[model samples]
Target: MNDTNSLEPVTAAAVYRAYNGGYFKTLVSPEQTGGSFALLEMVLPQGAEPPAHLHEKEDETFYVLDGTVSFRIGSKTYIAGPGETIFAPRLIAHEFRITSSQLHFITLLTPGSFWDYFMEFSTAADAVPVVKAPTELPPADFLMHLINRLNSQYGVKLV
Candidate 1:
């Protein structure tokens, strides 16, 4: 177990860029939190959205910081703006999209290991500002293979 008593600062150089013009800053990683939870801040451009997925072992919470976002949690949909928060329980299918030009939010996942998924899929090339549509994204099978591996390793399900 790791100590959670120390202060963790957010550094500009620590941002992780996603393939779709989105940026992630890991605030409290699993290793830092004793595997209890991980908190990350994400900045997503308009039209940015993640495929619907569920965590088999981690509950997720999102806190909107700027702009607006559309979130689909299970059968319900929600439009959240700055200062709002949303929760997605473990085992529930959920996805979110940036409804405004840009959206910033903080996501916290319980049990922490899911943080590796973001780190795994990110690359240096993603630092370049480029937003592609879902249709223009990478091959589904390839992504699925990676997702499956992550699921086996981290207990996340890309459904």
Candidate 2:
């Protein structure tokens, strides 16, 4: 493990724009964490349905900061609100949808390399919108194939 003294506080985070018109702000990058983990703040608009998928390389944990998110992990479903947390271990099929007008949450991915998925899928943005308006998603049939194709490159499998 790297020395603790190597770590520095992040007072500001850069915003990234996702395909669904939501936002992701990386709080602690893999480089900052010595490749052990990456931390991000996610601001998702309601009705965003992330395709069910499983990571082959890393585990994920979500901590709700505000609003709610409905998650399906394997066969179980959970609704998380502020102050709640959920975990999806590697190889576990999990999907989540923003259930409130907007949901703000923190995401932590262990082994950090998997953070590349966000880097690959989202791009730097000007800001994180306060009133998140739902964006129209692609058709489900088309979305599944698209997610499968894109996620595969990152060792994430559509499930």
TM-score of each: 0.77, 0.78
Best by lDDT: 2
Stretch of 10 with least lDDT, candidate 1: 125-134
> Counting only residues 3 or more apart in sequence or on different chains, how many pairs clash (N, Cα, C under 3 Å) in candidate 1?
0
Tens digits of per-residue lDDT, candidate 1, 36-70, equal 99998877777657678888889999999998988
Q: Evaluate model 1: give its lDDT.
A: 0.79
Error of 1 at 23 (Å): 1.1
lDDT for residue 97 in candidate 1, whole number 0-100: 75
- Compose the digit string of candidate 2's lDDT tens values, residues 1-159: 447668654332355656355778788999998999999888877776567888888999999999988999999999999999999999999999887888889999998887777786666665544545755666898767657655666688877
For model 1 the local lDDT of residue 121 reads 77
Stretches of candidate 1 exceeding 4 Å from the true structure? 1-15, 124-135
Which pairs of residues have clashing backbones in candidate 1?
none
